[model samples]
Target chain A: MKKLQIIALIFSILFAIIIVQSCKSTSNITESKFGAQLWGENCIRCHNTPSPETFSDTEWDVAVMHMRVRANLTESEAVKIADFLKTAN
Target chain B: MAFGQLYKITKEISNQVNIHKMKNLIILILSFFLILLMNQNVKAQDIQSTDEIQKLKQEIELLSKQNNSYKPGKSQFLLRGYAHSGLQTNNNGFSFVGGSFNPLLIYKQSDRLLFETELEMELVGSAVELGIEYANISYLLSKNITIRAGKMLVPFGIFVPNLHPAWINKFPTAPLGAGHEGILPTNDIGVEIRGGSYLGNLKVNYSFFAVNGGQLNDGMEEPEEAGIIHHGIFPDNNNGKTIGSRIGIFPFSNSSMELGFSAMYGKTGARESDVEDIKALHYAFDISYVKTLSSMSSVLDLKAQYTGVNVSDANYPEHDDPDELYTFDNKSKTWFAQLSLRPALVENPIVRNLEFAIRYSDLLTPEGAEWHVNQSQTDVGINYWFDWRTVVKFSYRIRSGFEGGHSEEPSHGGVEEDGGNSFFIHWAIGF
Candidate 1:
């Protein structure tokens, strides 16, 4: 139907926009640096920033992974955040 | 001739030849001996090299072995949740009520999969009423996609899943129709696909789901409850598939703003019960902005959402008169806007921990339904943060509405303004 086609077209346009912007992003940079920035911006989205020392390194792995699903963080972003947490902790 | 001399000379010649031969033989013998000695020396050096390598390998083994006490376990378990107890005073009287604790269990089966659930237990009268608010298993299908199955908070808006916790909610109560009895359903049984990504600097998240959605309570338990949507986890004989989606966009680099859109569609009537096919459609728009202003030394947080539901015209039995049926344009809408400010960076610790919030909410339902409501409510509150996950909130609410709207139809006289006022004090903590 025409409605379905229009919906598909809108989604395609949105996907194209995302791809174009992703190409311009600094995604190629080191994850540690990106993770550091992500941590500074994201953890406060719902609650306060958790202290790095509050959890063990292994505990952070589970905690951050949970947040990945709960907060809807990207896989790379989760891993990078995990890496930074471990290093900081 | 001198024969004896000649013989002596010949003998001398022979002896000289023999001496030359002996000299060559002795040189050959000495060379052979020197080569043998060099071979022995090389063998000795080889043995020493082999001994040193053996020693090095032993040291390497010793250093390679360690306790390894801190490596990740095969599985992980964490207990997390929030608890709150509150008392409210109305125009009539005050009662110590609404005490509840939500215990969450998270089992990380692996890095790629997890199981979690929350038990919402509340104290009502003298009994503890408990319910499983959500229970689901999630598998990380890929870096950008996650597949989940079980009871989940319907992602119609950000509030239900992300900010309903008492510690995070600025006010003591839910915004006007956003609560359990609100137009929106809290959660449902379903399968969902959800994920998030960074579209350049702009962040995005989305959820798509299929659920066995709400059923119309036509066999009204109460005369007023007719036409109400009962969203329990039960199978509908209609067998219609209910599908929904929510997409959230955050445009700021600081992730301080999010705009969301949502929609859901399905049939609400049960076919086995011989009810006519009735369809329902729902839409919602929500926005949230939370920003820390450096110059002002304060944080400004704002949230707003508008939700609308429309169901096809359907007849429902009147509880008072069993044979009689009624129908109405089944439509409902609800909206709430809340803003809060916190001086988090103030020099004084006590003052910095304080927050002020105000919310305005409005709602409207079908004019014919007993549960119909036409009114708006305003709430103002002050909250003090004990820590990041603990808070004490004091809120006052004023609800004003058109008389005879939610309960019944007005008489010959046009509806008059009606409402109520209440105050609440609550303490919430998360662990």
Candidate 2:
């Protein structure tokens, strides 16, 4: 009986750990591996999390122009950022 | 003992996972609440820009008007008056304490019609003037047009008929004697048509009338010809009554441009002036523009005009001589360019609608034109809009050169010199 109980406890503990792990990543919908990696390196430093509604469509249009001048963000990187922000919300 | 230990281990692990989930849950809820607060702020700002508050204010005004109406079986009457007094000085040393009162009386007859009349009094010359500033039965032709006739203020150029000095401009005075010259005619006996279309941005106006051309009582003064007394109001002048017409267009809201031309000729002349029946032609062009500069946080408005008057030689009906000894030709022109700048466009509790402006004008007259003079007046002033329809103005003005020499008025009792210092205040209202 003692041995059986130990085995059951071990299985339950492992199950709980797996559930927490699944939930941790459940809401992080940055699905594209390349997009997520790029965001990790470029965006996460400035912002804790990316959200779309931070800037209006027109505001984003102006911001992109400013970023190009100041940050020298490449066209592809800008496109990636725009897509992420547009969908983040 | 081993089974009990295993149970304890399982329970501890479950508690740990639950606490972790609670922490994450709290973070998510807090973040959402923060976002919601931010969104509310953004929405409030959007509402302000859309002028929703103005709509509410208009509704309040309408309600107040209804509440103030007379009870059934009685006539409703309203009296509103405005007054102002100010001490002002200019860099050129012209200064004074001057003011004006423009009070209006209104009678309401249901929603279809209203009667209105205004009287004006000025401190300069301590002038007291009374007239039916606007007295016409306005027949609502349609939502787009109103036809009115009677002794009506002539609907001419944007400013000629609407020059209250107090309401439309910043300067306590007006464009180069525009206020005092009494050069421009005011009210006339005529029919006027006025209305709006194009989404309330464009206004169309027209008028036709016959009037006692030089009725000083009507706030209009006609120039006197040499040897001809009261040339403008004499019975002979009206026996050959003069006719005039005007058309005005406001292509956009807050901007109006008008071009007007009037010609009157008849056997009208002062007695014995036989003054051959005289024909006179007058043409005036006025253009005004207003712009809202969001980038500069200011508003700029410009107004300009050019006018010319030609009088033909008259034949003496009483004189048998082939040539009359007294014959003169007269022509006059005036031009003005003005700029107004109002910073801090938004109104606050302390600072209201305040504008600073400058104007340069040159008025030209025939070297020997009857009752005319050539002079240039430059003015700088500030307009403080106390309310929607009330404003206080302070201006400093300088005038120079009676172009041809001394002004014709100098030959009379009028003052003629390089210039003189003048200061004044005015109060105005419109419904």
Candidate 3:
């Protein structure tokens, strides 16, 4: 069906972008503390930034994981954000 | 006499020698005793010094323990909220509304326990109303599982829990059937277990809950006036319980694509009642995809959901009123799709963040229902983000096919049967 084709096309493009981005040297990207920066940048886009101490380290792990999928963050970016949140409290 | 004098002289000389020797021996013994006393004093001083050092060491250990006991990130409480104000214009006229001020309270008890509550106050014309949206307590059982209890937002779909925030909603209003007055149950008193895990390159999340079943109103005068099946707000007269679950999958590690499904089932009748117990079943499917174009500094978000509800044996008694003869349908369905594009991915000094979005929704009720049960709406909006948690939105909505003709004023905002169009400009902020 045409709908299937459109969906496939979208995924293909997304996968292509991921492949390209992954090929680049990420040494410079990981050097900066992406955790705190990404947390402020992405988490607040939808709702207020909850105080870091609002959830414990274990709770933050789950919360950040949920948001990562809900908000569309890369795995590395999600992990970094999760790390900062767990320690920030 | 000469011999006795010589003997006495010799004896006297011997006595003098003996006396001198005895005196020398006594002095030597005294000197030895003085040395022993000196040694005893030095040993006592040494013992005292050792005891003082031991006391100082114990004090240092106590201070160290106190310093370690002061945890930097312990339990805490916080208050945060959001407010919305806007103007809406329809066929009737323009009205100014001071929409709602919702305050949320969050308490973190420990690494394992948390509590959250939200109170919503809204102004309708000159009247004010207050309600509790959600109040729940959660305890983490492990790294991947949590147990939650209390009044919570129903986990039937993604819209209520994820996108209902005023600042986050793509449009000014919710899609048909998903709003406060929607047919779908938006909140429930219940307990749930939720968690997430990763499988290879994919991620998985799930929630399972049990709650009081919906209330059934069976004493209505007419079939069309059926009152049963109020979404689980109050204590259930029936002995039935509702069970629900939702599962989601993220297939790719690099891509933000989520696919989810949810289902709930329960009975809505009292035990051994005149009316046959109604069997209620509901299910929903939802998906979301987000893509960021680094070259263009743009982001695209797509989200959609489809929900359906079915009630079995909902036939009602016929009444003398002619208009009430129609039987309510056993099934209803609703769905919405939304797309949003944010052009300013990078923070621009002046332009900041700008986003455009469009959404379409449809709600279908059981055929032959007395009221207007079929509804559809389209919304197009533009959002200007002053900051991450604050936004100004301009939206135009075209709504049709609403039920009307009730004498009583509507509890929540409901349009007339002949639906009208409206333009709304609302400012939303979270703090």
Candidate 4:
């Protein structure tokens, strides 16, 4: 009984935060060749940054999507990172 | 008259033989001269055919491009993963260990759909072992949501999916309680809804899933492996599905820090059995902070997580006597905290590549269970970076518990029973 209550409470709080915060925030989408910045910020969080030349454009497509899921990146961020790798390469 | 006839026949025979020899010698000489003339003729023709050869090369290049164009463009395939080879000395003896090749395959069917698979191959003793860590397909539903199904890593904590890779982990070995017998679940079979968005200044992401929860080991087949839950196994033991989620909150604009919370609720005991209604609640909290201190010319990484499982009261068979049923407060708890420091901006190349890390972890299982124990471990480690995705790690560990690193003996135990006071040297590479 206590366990259920605790889980319910946690979920409720999480939902409340999502509702309140989402309303206060502006969309976080900007397209300014920001792939370089996205690549640096997310890659460094867990491991070192990989070079743009490390993968081909097609490989980067798959690689960035894998990272998108593993690191919880938005689809927009994933696409921008992919575009940067393609352009840089 | 006979003698005269014989002499005449002999002369005729000799003349014929001489004629035959002359014809043979003439043919041999003519054949040799013919070969020599052909060789020179071929050489002269080659020198005159350079333009033809160039035209042929151009044709070949065109054909190559045509072949490349015929390849399918809608689908893409990628092979990437990590591998490690190293040596170690546990309390039992000095030996070579830690050899594995983990490969991940991702095949994109369209812009929003992909199939991913990860295979783990390890060198164990004299044989090679193979396993499928996860095989799943995901579809991007929208900006804030994606759907995935099949076997995948449980979102119980950050370590399993994100930080357990050899090249990414600062230490050579895993934290004490993160292993096979640990409180955290590694993988599960389920459907998941995963995504996140920027909320104000905060970046929040979550993975919510429903899985056939892990099974409660009954100590039937292996006593040492009993009393605990076995994760990612096949064939559901019960109809109840476990519902779980992991939510990560990144408070900083630069995403330097992440705080995570995870919760799982489901029935684990076998259905149509004595303890079908008994359920388990698992929860975890994790935090990671990383920063580059310009003044100190160094980088610091700090990580910590706490995880526990609460199983409702149930009667389980005792390890010693199968007929004897025993019950206790069924719960398992584990926690680990680690810090890593590296002079990433130092002028000296050698100094800049060196990293130092220390960690403390504790594991506490149900007291009366076969795998029960109150244990603690401390590890000090150093690593030399070869590049962004390669490193050589050296670490030493100290163990203290009622039986030290041994989690067995009472029966149905987990982890290496003899791995106490260990030393490790590992080389990890990611590609």
Q: Write the per-residue lDDT of candidate 4 for residues B1-431, one digit (tens) a residue.
A: 99999999999999999999999999989999999999999988997798789999999999999989976596899999888877777757776664678898999998889899988887666677788889999998776678899999888887777787777877766776776456678788999988767666568888888999888876666666556777777878999999988889888777789999998888887778776777888888999888888998998888999999888887777668878888888888888899999999999999999999999988888887767778888889999998889999898888788643324311011112364777778888999
lDDT of 1 by residue, B1-431 (tens): 69999999999999999999999999999999999999999999999999999999887776665434544577998888888877778867777656678898988999899999989887656678788889999999877778899998887886777778887888777766666656776789999878776665557877778888878766645566767676655765468878877778887766778898877778787776534477677778999888888998998888899998888887777768968998887898988999998999899999998999999988888888767788888999999998878899898888888533343211001111124677888888888
Compared with the true structure, all predictions reach lDDT values of 0.77, 0.47, 0.68, 0.80
Instruction: Output the number of the DockQ-best candidate.
Output: 4
**Which residues of candidate 3, in runs, are more than 4 Å off?**
A1-82, A85-89, B1-73, B219-228, B319-328, B346-352, B402-418
Give the top-scoring candidate (lDDT).
4
Cα lDDT, model 2, residue A86: 53
User: How would you order the candidates by TM-score, starting with the best?
Assistant: 4, 1, 3, 2
Query: lDDT per residue, candidate 2, B13-70, as tens digits?
Result: 9999999999999999999999999899999898886787788889999998887773
Deviation from native of the Cα of residue B94 in model 4, angstroms = 2.1
> What are the RMSDs of all candidates, in order?
10.3, 28.4, 11.9, 16.5
TM-score of each: 0.79, 0.55, 0.71, 0.82
Error of 1 at B20 (Å): 56
Tell me, by TM-score, which candidate is best.
Answer: 4
Question: Model 1: runs farther than 4 Å from truth?
Answer: A1-33, B1-71, B274-276, B403-419
DockQ values for all predictions? 0.30, 0.01, 0.07, 0.33
First chain of candidate 4, TM-score: 0.74
- Rank order by DockQ, top first? 4, 1, 3, 2
Q: Report the backbone clash tally of model 1.
A: 0
Clashing pairs in 3: B216-B228, B216-B229, B217-B228
Q: Give residue B425's lDDT in candidate 1 (0 to 100).
A: 83
